[model samples]
Target chain A: MTVEKISSLQNPRVKQLVKLRDRRPRDEAGVFLIEGFREIRRALEKRVPLRELYYAPEWFLGENEPALIAQAEAAGAQLFELTKSAFAKVAYRERPDGLLAVAPQWKRTLQDLDKIVAGSGGPGRPGSTTPATTSAVGAGAPDLQRAPFILVVEAIEKPGNLGTILRSADAAGCDAVIVCDPVTDIFNPNVVRASTGVLFSVPLVVAESAPVLAWLRAQGVRTIATTPAAEKLYTDADLRGPLAIVMGSEQYGLSEFWLKNCDLPVRIPMAGQADSLNVAMATIITLFEAVRQRAW
Target chain B: MTVEKISSLQNPRVKQLVKLRDRRPRDEAGVFLIEGFREIRRALEKRVPLRELYYAPEWFLGENEPALIAQAEAAGAQLFELTKSAFAKVAYRERPDGLLAVAPQWKRTLQDLDKIVAGSGGPGRPGSTTPATTSAVGAGAPDLQRAPFILVVEAIEKPGNLGTILRSADAAGCDAVIVCDPVTDIFNPNVVRASTGVLFSVPLVVAESAPVLAWLRAQGVRTIATTPAAEKLYTDADLRGPLAIVMGSEQYGLSEFWLKNCDLPVRIPMAGQADSLNVAMATIITLFEAVRQRAW
Candidate 1:
């Protein structure tokens, strides 16, 4: 596990770092980005396929730890020690913790998810341990294709917000995150960073609202629109069945078309002076309600 | 409304902008900072009190909307215009929106909340609305003071997350955000920015675990701790009662003290590979449940 140093930002290997910051390059390569020592460690620990590891020796104090260095070395990850200045040009964060890695997309299909659930012996997801659990794929779930305890985000403008929602989706164990009319790329560098790498952990499908909704309906998923104006409270609406919680941008909530088509309009209750929560915040509440109801 | 432009970062007025960004300065001066045209417009629309407004020509695009300029002038707001480059230095945002405003803090008290509910005749709080209603906040005839909802955020590190929680607190109409122990400053600049200025809107107070539990017990706020381990689903708990939902950081979850003190431990059921949601996202979910339980 020898340390190799790369000073030129234009080096073929260094160019990959620059490209990782750009969404198109990341997508074209079919690989996801992970940065920082902890993120790199998580990737290595997960046994997710590794592509390369870039480091700056002067800064990465963790390099002295043989075990940490050996783990990446064992995986055949390309290691590059960079000058701090050179690292800055390609690092995701201004203060890159001296380790960066790019890993092939963590691939899992709907069928693959089923196999994991069977293997887990509790449920297909974490935090879902109900003995009587409804199957997510082609089960009695409504809108099995269009919505099934899923989340549809329409026209979210901020990458941080979108990624934050993905983090929540991972926690709530929502089926998938459907980005409808995205204003920011789901694979944007910032989104991936903000998601704390949950982007890799979650199954994200991006599509236009029309097709997204159409697919959900085909799958027998009910479209539940969460809004400030609603006939049903979020908790009372039966979330135990096939469901997709639809939320909109912060300034303009679910579009009229989306709202009009909602099987149920649900809202989180509030008592303080707040008029509304941010869209990302709203998504967490609605998605978890689905989680709560199913677990109960 | 005259367009006054001053081009100098060293000017006394420019120094004031720096002070506004600092919480201590704002607190001593009894003010809060708001930047960007959209935020300024919202403040004016709310008829919120204003102290000052500053900007550069780049923000207005030379198309003068009298209303925007007049709102400040009518409010007797002192306006200053700087050279675009100087304005850029003075403004917090990279793409300077040009306009920045300083307004007195509107520290909402219990009495003022009563006035809002009475004037509008809206629901008092969660669990107070009609059973069939889905309006998140209006679900019930709100009970403002004894509003059972409470929030306990444990050891949150990011300023953005804290700010977002405050924003969620306002939207969820939470009683108060009880920071069990926070890792980041509640008043960090990033928190203020991310909250969309809700830092001034919500009742956020920090307290240790014992006092928090004591307050909950005194208020009869049923303490519900959210964790990955909880077998009973969040919805399974009687959410309608006086409730304090406790959620900790993603790393460790609610502290041992909270765990020992909580009346119930609940979880948002999940069906995904990722184990947890961001702290901010989880707070939104917990907050909405209180919203949902109280809605009816």
Candidate 2:
């Protein structure tokens, strides 16, 4: 028998789910969410902690049900159920994916990053005194080579755009993502859903522009700014260098200050009628450009 | 103060608007659509004809109102008034943009492509005998160089992704976009909304894959296929040649048959954990590579 709780839309859990619909809840609770069957399954299978799991009884029932129930029971996840209508209210999309989860935020400190790197089996980071490849670190070695490829989204709006960006970035083997001045919250349910749980895997750093810039500089990283005004095209830029390509918002573009200040300002050339490209596209090209460069 | 003859929600006009919401309407009417304030404004000001426009009288009277009404009227747009709820029903998003319009679908054929090139005073097209050296093509000259760099997409699904790709392609100055096995109509209201009317300006062609592939071959185009399995990096490939970079859907990637049968199979290198870059990003980087190669 399932643990049952019948509650109105005003119930505390439901309210928490509503607040979780946006980014505010994640910041407040130090927890973010994941949704859809595949994503939630990945999180559970990976031994990631789940603070909550909501399923539609009407939609979910199978031989695998007991395992899911036991896993949540084992992890002490707050298990809840809602009728399709009630579940519908909390889900961002009109169709509920039959399962939803709230996973603990992987709050990582700078020292945590350093510790993980030092623990990798490799000699050390490429530039660092210690150098190691990623595979070398798996057996309790600090492999510098396995260090996550960092994706820094300078300024972006539109949850769907951000989600797609993250999903693609994740698929490309990026180590993590740092979103500065994100238009939507990293924890927004839609982002989690759209990213296909890439947000969970990515160590997303949210901060103001200045500190983030400064951090990258301290790391001796190259900052590549994307713009139409630049003379050099993206492919021409040396993307293989430890780089953090900066992308701008939908409207104005990477500010002139960023252009002047960035280590390098590169353009993606236009061959046709429109003056500029979309922010999402710019981010993707910059990312792949780095990939192409690295492969060289 | 508003023309209200198309009063019934079931009116043929309303049905057309709803149908236009889907790509089928775009096909049936042989026209696409645009929504919101600025986009519609530009389209009208550019002498683009409007089949019909829907707006709530009180809503348009609010802020930034006069310019919209005048523009629509001067363009001879058929205007209509709808109850707030009814208008929302016609619009895709829950909230209406205060205005939406249907206009002719843009379909520039391949025959005229040669004509467009002769107009471009600059001989910029790769491998072509003529060069578009200047921006001064006479009335009789074709702007073949209006965009010499062209990208052909095969069976893309998401409208947002297509719109984003167009935006990026526009920034790259891509000549025209030919969608082969298109999943969504290029002129869908959402795609148009996403492209900011760049859709209107960009010469798009919708056709099947086989014919487009044949045409590219006949053009002596170096067709590059982007896939994860390829051994060569995107940068390693010669991008400056007369090329038609064929990129596939984000989900399935370039079809296996497409990859086996096409000219070249190439991959973009990835680091960290991701398998691939987002499609739009991939397109931009791929297109930009050509622009960069040609620039220097």
Best by DockQ: 1
Q: What does candidate 1's lDDT look like per residue over B1-296, in tens digits?
A: 57667787788878877877776787787776677765566556445566788777775644543467578879778777778877877788767767777776533223333333233444443333233221121223344544446677888887777877777877877755667666765655577577765554344556667876776675556888988788987766787766778888867777888888799998765544444466676677767776766766
CAPRI rating of model 1? acceptable
* TM-scores for the candidates: 0.77, 0.82
Candidate 2 Cα deviation (angstroms), residue B194: 2.3
Residue A268 in candidate 1, Cα distance off native in Å: 4.9
| Best model number under lDDT | 1
Q: In candidate 2, what are the lDDT values of residues B1-296, reduced to their tens digit?
A: 45764457777777777787776657887766667777787565444677677776544535765568667877677777677666666777655666877777655555434443334443332222342221221111224533245678888888977887776666665656778888877777767766766665555678888877776666666688888789987777877656677889978888765787678877766543343356776777777777766565
The 10 consecutive residues of candidate 1 chain B with the worst lDDT sum are B132-141
Q: Tens digits of per-residue lDDT for model 2 on A1-296?
A: 35666347777877787786656666778777677676676565445677788877666645565577668768678788777767777776666566777776554434334433333453332212332122221111225453335566766777776877786676555544677766777667767666765654544567667776777776666788888888886776777655677877777777665677789888865544344556766677677667655655
